[model samples]
Target: MPVITFANTKGGAGKTTAVLLLATELARMGHRVTVLDADPQLWISRWSEMSGEMRNLSVISHVTMASMETHIRENRSNTDCFIIDLPGTKSPLLTMALGISDHVLIPVQGSAMDARGASEVLEHIELLNRKMGMKIDHSVVLTRVNAMISTRSMLLVKALLAEKNVRVLNTPIAERAAFRDIFDCGGTLEALDCQKVSNVEKAMENVRNFAYEVLRLMPVRVVRSDRDGKFLGRKAA
Candidate 1:
């Protein structure tokens, strides 16, 4: 199973939103998913509980690193994917999650300030990769991007990090009220729109594709994709 941890050193980076949305997308694609909520805030956990019936996904709260690891090890055999929503700041739980993660998705707003804060998280990942034999996959996901801002802060950061050979997913999540409003109602992007707001629809499409791309990098089971690039399975794997 692939274990993906959404982590960052700074708070208010949309970590919970990313985790909740991504997990919903993955589950909708038909993959057996288990979400481990390491944040003491339990935002994702509560959201999952309130949302109720998810087809093939399960969400559970694990406050400590030890418990998280134990859960991963014990349930790894039964699950096809594990998505961990971590706290904003560094903690023992976050460290343990990183140590066992197959991939780390760091979501940041497309701004100079957020870019600077992201650097610290990137540096720590680099250190972990070098010091330990762990090969943790990672990528930077640009969030809350405004198209009017011609100068793309995320693109600039991607250029700067090119020398390090880090990969940035092509799909940049644009700022959308749909995303912001969905949290309160516990709704997924897929459930929100069918015809209107094409941009938001396309953004959700990109998110689904990006999730598959991350899975592909890990050499996990390739999800069958149709001509439109949408995964054909009930969930992504």
Candidate 2:
């Protein structure tokens, strides 16, 4: 399984939202997805509880540095992708997760503070690469973007990432009411009521594109077994 981690050293950068979108989308696409909720706030865990049981999707709550690897090792065979939601602060867990992850996604908002938080994460990854020779794959994904207009701060953030030579996904998670309502409604975007939420279709499209970009970076290969008519998943080489 390819472990993809959503991490930022600062909170309110839409880290959890990105995690949920990717996990739900991948699960909806028939890939077994396991989410490790390492955030102490337990947002993902609470969402899972509210969402009840979903097919092809599982959430492990209260994951810590000590239990992180054990959980991944135990669930490796069954999961096609492992999404790790790290806490929004500077912690040792960030380093540990970075080392193990196949790709680290740092969600950054259109503000200086968010940029600084992303910088901390990028620095940590660099440290791992330089000090330990662990060149972890990573990218900065812009989140909570205004769909209608590009603010000056957003442009600056993009420029900064370009200046730093950081790879950023072209697709950005738009600021949508449906993105927030999913937390309260406790279901995937497909399960949400279009009548109750404004621009639900647009929100779903954004997530679809976001998930598509993520899968492009870290793909899961599924092959069929001729004898048993079963499908086996492996991380793409």
Candidate 3:
């Protein structure tokens, strides 16, 4: 199984929203996903409560630094992927989660251009690499990008990140009402009613691309089991 952590010390950077989209999408693809709701607000846990028993999806709430590794070890038997949603402010858990994560996804708001929070995370990763020699794979996922934004502006954001040698995902998460609606409705994008939600199809496509890119970047070996007729992820020991 692969552990993917979303970290941004700055609040309102859309970290939790990104986590929800990726977790649901991965579960929809038949991979069992366990989300550790480390955020104090417990947004993911609340969303899971609103969401009725989704197959291959589970949420562990009130997670702490001490419990992080224990949750991973205990859930390793059934979990295909572990996603940790960290708090918005800088804390010890931020470093603790990053230390265990296979990939740290730092969500940066597009309109706000909140690079400071993302920079903090990047610096921590660099420090770990330099001081402890721990190389953790990570990326910046641009979120809440306006659909009407100019091509020039989007390119500029890309240019700025590239200038700093930051690796970013090609698929940017667009600002859409459907993304907000999911938190209220408590269901996956595919389950959302097309007539009720506007631009739902486009939102689904964007999330699909994002999830596919992450899967490609961190390829987990999936095995087929005859007993349950479901896939099991194999992690290297």
TM-score for all models, in order of appearance:
0.84, 0.95, 0.92
Which pairs clash inside model 1? 29-234, 29-235, 29-236, 30-234, 30-235, 31-235
Which residue segments of model 3 deviate by more than 4 Å?
111-113, 151-155, 223-229, 232-237
For residues 1-237, what per-residue lDDT tens digits would candidate 1 score against the true structure? 778888877888878887877787777776668999888899887777777877767888865766887888888765677999888886777667878887888887866666665676777777887898666778887777674563556667667657667677666666776667566666577676556534667667767876666666664663534545454443333
Instruction: Report every candidate's CA lDDT.
Output: 0.73, 0.91, 0.87
lDDT of 2 by residue, 109-148 (tens): 9999999999999999999999999989999999999999
For model 1, what is the alpha-carbon lDDT of residue 7? Answer: 80
Best by TM-score: 2
> For each candidate, how many residue pairs have backbone atoms clashing (under 3 Å)?
6, 0, 0
Q: What is candidate 2's CA lDDT for residue 13?
A: 93
Model 1 has an lDDT value of 0.73
Ranking by TM-score: 2, 3, 1
Q: How does candidate 3 score on lDDT?
A: 0.87
Kindly report which residue pairs in candidate 3 clash with one another.
none
